[model samples]
Target: MKVKVVSLLLFMTGVMTFAQEDLKEREQQAAFDPAYTSYSRKKPAYVTLKDGTKIEGHIKDVDRKKGQIHRLKIIEDGKKKVEIQATDIADLYMAPSGLEQLDKQANFFNDATKWGKTDATKHLSKGYTMYTNQMVSLKNKKKPTEYLMQVVNPKYSQVIQVYSDPFAKQTASIGVGSLKLAGGIAKSYYVKKGEEIVWLTKSNLDEHFDRLFMDSEDFKSKYEGEKFKWSLLGVYILDYTEFALDAQMGEAK
Candidate 1:
């Protein structure tokens, strides 16, 4: 009789353990599960938190209780001198994007091109391609568009590669130099743990880029296409250790 009771208790314990694990799995799925596969259109939505912080990137998840942004993405501004990214600015109004969003943008541009409505917006090419000399010059001159390349996936973009990641272990980092709207050079450093830094190397991920924009907003009249200027633009000539983020990386050289 005692043996039967012991066996039943063990079985019940196993069932409870499985049930708890299932619940955790569900929670993670609802929260951090992969939402993007190749050709998977991710949506764009501005998540306004209680603190009035607005960002222009895609929302990964929202932590309303903790007042935080999860998995937010922003374009890297090529000009700024600080670690904070200017594209990280959250707008009071949020824009939406999904896999279908790409098709929509394409369709809209296609219709415009089909109709020759050049005044509407400049037509955009689909996916990454070698930039034309004119396009390259314009982007290099403008700066913002040049840095937009980092928005997708730096590793996949293959423009800038991570040669090292010493924080996690020995590390290597790939850096490609880009210009700010005002002609300041910025190098983007990719860390192995899927983190990207545009100007300065370290990031907490939750910090917004509004200040960077505000600091760099002086060249409105000077730069023609997309106007971006930096306020405090002191250069940082430090080794990779300055970016001290808490993620595993390959090696630094």
Candidate 2:
């Protein structure tokens, strides 16, 4: 009886050790995975113009120069080839490739945006490509110009548009030797409402949250109650959008 009990204890210990190792491996894999993938392959696409016109086609290729989408080439109705400047696009949608789907799943698991359960991954899961062109100042550019960006909160289309910068990078220091690793994408978030676009950063999220979302009292209450962190900015935008939409619908009724 004593021998059996000892063996059972040893077995449980081994199981726990294996579980911890598995968890650690997952964490490491997630940490090294890229947050988003670039769209290059031809896929069935729908594009909305700045003037509210919609185009249906397959996106044959997207040219990126200096980490910004330089031009968009698409085949309309499988024949007419149309090349559009990045600035002319309001929204672009495409079906994800198998590899892109896997990337999205990995990003969702890692909570790349720190958006808790309410991140942009929900749209990707529902087959929303969520890409758009927005005016952003590039490091080499003298003026703010349009570039292809990912919409982090597509459901908030009416109130505000939250975008993830495709070219953004984050640097991390890790390991006993303090190795610095950089090259992470989509580390920055941008918000667009009306004619202006604002970068949502740790320094300005708190300051801008109320100013931009002053219409949603319910969201404000929740934000204050939670002592909102920068990581929760995505959730804040989503909740505020819902509340704002409700108010707008009520006013319409």
Error of 1 at 160 (Å): 29
What residue pairs clash in candidate 2, if any at all?
none
Return the lDDT, model 2, position 26.
38
- Assess each prediction's global lDDT (C-alpha) against the native: 0.25, 0.61
Q: Each prediction's TM-score against the native?
A: 0.19, 0.61
Report lDDT (Cα) of residue 33, candidate 1: 9
- Per-residue lDDT over 165-213 for candidate 2, one digit per residue giving the tens place of the 0 to 100 score: 5556553434211212334323466777777787766666667766777
Q: Give the per-residue lDDT digits (tens) of candidate 1, residues 1-253.
A: 9999999999999999997776444322211101122221243333233445533333333221111111233332342222222234221122223322231221322442222342112212323211110111121133322111112121122222222111111113321222112222222222222233332233421132332222222322223364222211111111111122111122332
